[model samples]
Target: MEVQSAGKETYRAKTSKGEATRQKLLDVAEEIFGAKGYFHTSVVDITQRAGVAQGTFYVYFPGKQHIFRELVEELSHNLRREIQIAVNGAAGRKEKEIRGFAAFFDYVRKHRNLYRIVQEAEFVDPALYKWYYRRLAEGYVKGLQEAMDRGEFRRLDPEAVAYCLMGMGEFLGMRWVLWEKKDVPEEAFRAAMELIMGGLEKRD
Candidate 1:
């Protein structure tokens, strides 16, 4: 449970309206930050676009950087939640990997600003930028390790494999969803799955 701190006072949305206002601010910030870039975006810009007073902004986020950081954290949380849900319904290790990749592409398609905002974070907040991917990779490593334990995947370094998978998904999303404004094509998806399964499937 995260609370918004304004000076000495801690602000938690006490009502539905209050929570809606806070969420509105975040939603507007995501659009502005993605379009204008962090350095160029201002608190006034966010407040005006959100149709909220400048003081209201402080009630939720202390400043611009706080909102930006919160946005990144929110994206990370939602992404992992979506991927986990999809992977959970999968029948086996191969299905889990395919489902996870599909979930990621779908997420990227929905959140078109994802790449822009994340890339800007490298300069906006270095630790947070790294934390985003590291958190994602943590989930990947855990799942890969489980598959290895079950002998579904060969015993290679889970962390290394996690990063490799992340890189592949990231670029594929960038190439297809972000650039082409479409889902990853069936041919490309099948090829990637074949390449991954070929490498990971256990042998006698």
Candidate 2:
């Protein structure tokens, strides 16, 4: 939905073919940007790998930076949305937290490029990099606040709690998924959940 164009018209893919081409470019760009640092990649590289004319890339994204920004935004949106869906129908805050971590690991396994691309955004566009995490943390903080109000979690600083949990999940995913090339082991998941559950859950 964050499509943009160089021209005043503001481009969008109106047909099936057009949409497919645009998606192809984004998919290829994700791989290219991940394998090669964003600073090293070019529009020509994306178009070549995507099997589309350079002009076709322009039809969807105005420039390399535009596509990178949009891709990061799209990734952030998808991650948050998936977490929301996974945590749905959970009976309690602890269950929601457990399911959310599972969903995150599942997503990372499928989109391994996300870790590289997100890190590169700090150099490519610092604002977009911050926006990505801030957007995710906003939802996390909201969830924490709700749990606190429900007496499920202790009354802690929601923002601090949000960052703590995010850091834990990020590192866990980085260690097991990105580095190990496998889903986090069941023992590791249980250990982490126990740590988080102890730290946040109310005693009484």
Candidate 3:
């Protein structure tokens, strides 16, 4: 699909073949950036790994920074979309949280490169790095606010709570799924949920 950059620069993949090529470049970028780290990976590295020419890289992305920014944006967007879909049709907010956390770990497992590329943004572009987390937190804040309004959760700072939850999922996913190459076990998932439920759930 055609995508416009934040600067209003258009990545016009005008044909099916062009769009495929663009996606191929991005796929290779994700792989290389995750494996080699952004600094060590060069445009030539991306092109060679993608089996595309140097000029072809320019067709989709202007330069390394621009592509890195796009990759961060894309990853941020795809993640939010996935989590939203995962939590859909849930029984309630509590169940939604459970499903959402499970979904997040599942996502991180599939996209094992998420942490490497996103964390590299701290050095590559600090603003974009913050933008990534802030964007993710926006959805979390909205959901938590809704849950509170529904009396499913206690009155608290939604944004702060969102960050707390996001932090929990980030580290848990990193340690269990990303690092260990395995799903979060059932007992551990329940323990984490109970710990969160203790504070978030409304009490008599």
Candidate 4:
């Protein structure tokens, strides 16, 4: 009983070691949730694979669903961070979009489980799934709107354009990285770029 009481004290990560343990649980949850899926995975599965005590799992996440939610949120943050970093030095909207796509492809390659986890979120938690994409679109729309204001891009509905661009990136990544386990081929990438840049380019 005393040991259980002590373990409950770790409900949230308060120290560096605690944070590491929390992150480990999240990492393990990401893998299991991506592979076995939310319904199929169990807390014990994450704990055993993570080499942590079952109580430790509860310490970080209240339940399996909490961990799954955290995983999706974390992936969203990491993907956006990578894209931002990749596009920071890009000179213009065109370069920024291209570099952003490249960054996304690289991230998907490394985190292939991304597709499974996010897609499954639609069923597991519909609102969460929508939140995931909306969070992504918010940043994209802001960037597109900025370009439109600068006359770099056509003055169109930024949100609409953002979704279309996101769809293109999503399918391209799915086809090349997730399905074929290869980089998006040069031709496909070029076609995508041309479609995006040509359509959005401001005309005289």
Candidate 5:
């Protein structure tokens, strides 16, 4: 009985260690992929940086492509959630849009490497590109449609509006925040909000 109990404890300890190792691999991969584009990063690089055997990486991911996909999916989910929270917490539609932009800029600032990985993946992986933008556009459309229905804005094609607003925000963010290596000021976000609101405002 004692031997059996010892065996069970050993198994539990091994499982815990395995989980920790997997997390470490993912963390290292995020940094590497962020710094080096997805196409440029390699499995060897990941294993070396993770300080694990090459075979150990296979235990958690089939290949580098799998890891890239996983990272993109994770980032996409996080961005969606952040945008949702920002929009939901606002008192008005205009405020919500501004907050949404702010949240996205903040996220990019915190995970600039991850952002680069995402951008690289868009060129290398069409599925990932479609998945990320589709989800993002859907969220924006839902928010805009809801606001319009509530009389916060004029009625317009939600899909078109979503695409336009997101495109504008993305370009502004990439130029000012990402390319310029500057933080996204609140005033910048407010300016974006004003431009969007002006276009969508209802005429009396």
Candidate 6:
């Protein structure tokens, strides 16, 4: 029994170490991929940049494509979480929409590299792009649907509304964070949200 327990502990330790190594590789890979792009980055580049063995990279990620996919998925997850937090904290539909937009734009500004990677993935891999957009669209749809159900917003197709909102957010994020060399001010995002919700809000 003692030997079995000790062996399990050793396995767990090794597993944890492997996961750490994998994450390190991914971190470096994301940086390089974002700077150099998916087509230009190689496994050797990641391993060298990450200070890990080439074989180690293969163990965690099959290749550059796999790493790109993982990066996209991770970014998507983070974006979703940020938006959810912002929306959940708001007191009303208008506030929720503003908060959601703020959270997304803030995230993009702070994580510009990751955002660029996401944009590249959209062009390089259609399937991954679809998956990313689907998740984003679903989040927006749910938020709009909630507002409509609460009688806080006018009647409309949640999915369509969500897409429009997301499109506007995406373009704003890209312009201020990705293409333009500056931080997006909070007021800018707030104004954009106001414009979007201006026509959509339910009048008392």
Best by TM-score: 3
Please estimate how well model 3 matches the true structure, expressed as its whole-model Cα lDDT.
0.89
Per-model CA lDDT versus the true structure: 0.89, 0.89, 0.89, 0.89, 0.78, 0.78
User: How many residue pairs collide in each prediction?
Assistant: 0, 0, 0, 0, 0, 0
Q: TM-scores, in order shown?
A: 0.94, 0.94, 0.95, 0.93, 0.84, 0.86
State model 2's lDDT: 0.89
Prediction 6 TM-score vs. true: 0.86
User: Each model's RMSD to truth, in Å?
Assistant: 2.9, 2.8, 2.7, 5.8, 8.4, 7.2
lDDT of 4: 0.89
- In candidate 4, stretches whose alpha carbon ends up further than 4 angstroms from where it belongs are 1-11
When summed lDDT is taken over every stretch of 10 residues in candidate 2, the lowest stretch is 1-10
* Deviation from native of the Cα of residue 27 in model 5, angstroms: 2.6
On residues 12-114, what C-alpha lDDT tens digit does candidate 2 reach at each position?
7889998888778888988999999798999999999988999878878879988888788778889999999999999999899999999999999989999
- What is the per-residue lDDT of model 4 for residues 1-204, given as tens digits with 9 covering 90 to 100? 101222343366779998998899989888888889889999999999989999878778878877877788889889999999999979999899889999999999999899999999899878788888989999999999999999999999999999999999999999999999999999999999999999999989
Off by over 4 Å in 1: 1-10
Residue 109 lDDT, candidate 4, scale 0-100: 97
Q: What lDDT would candidate 1 get against the real structure? A: 0.89
Model 6 weakest 10-residue run by lDDT:
1-10
Candidate 3 C-alpha lDDT tens digits along 117-193: 99999999888888888889988999999999999999999999999999999998988998789998889889889
Greater-TM-score candidate between 2 and 3: 3
Q: Which stretches in model 5 have alpha-carbon errors above 4 Å? A: 1-19
Encode model 6's per-residue lDDT on 1-204: one tens digit a residue: 111112222222257789798779768977898889888888999999889989878776666777777777777788889889877867988888777877887888767786678778777777777778887898788878888999989989889988888888888878887788566666877678778778789988
- For residues 1-204, could you state the per-residue lDDT of candidate 1 as single tens digits? 232322234366779999999889889988999999999999999999999999989888878988888888888889999999999868999999999999999999988899899999899988788888989999899999999999999999999999999999999999998889999999999988998999999989
Which is superior by lDDT, 3 or 5?
3
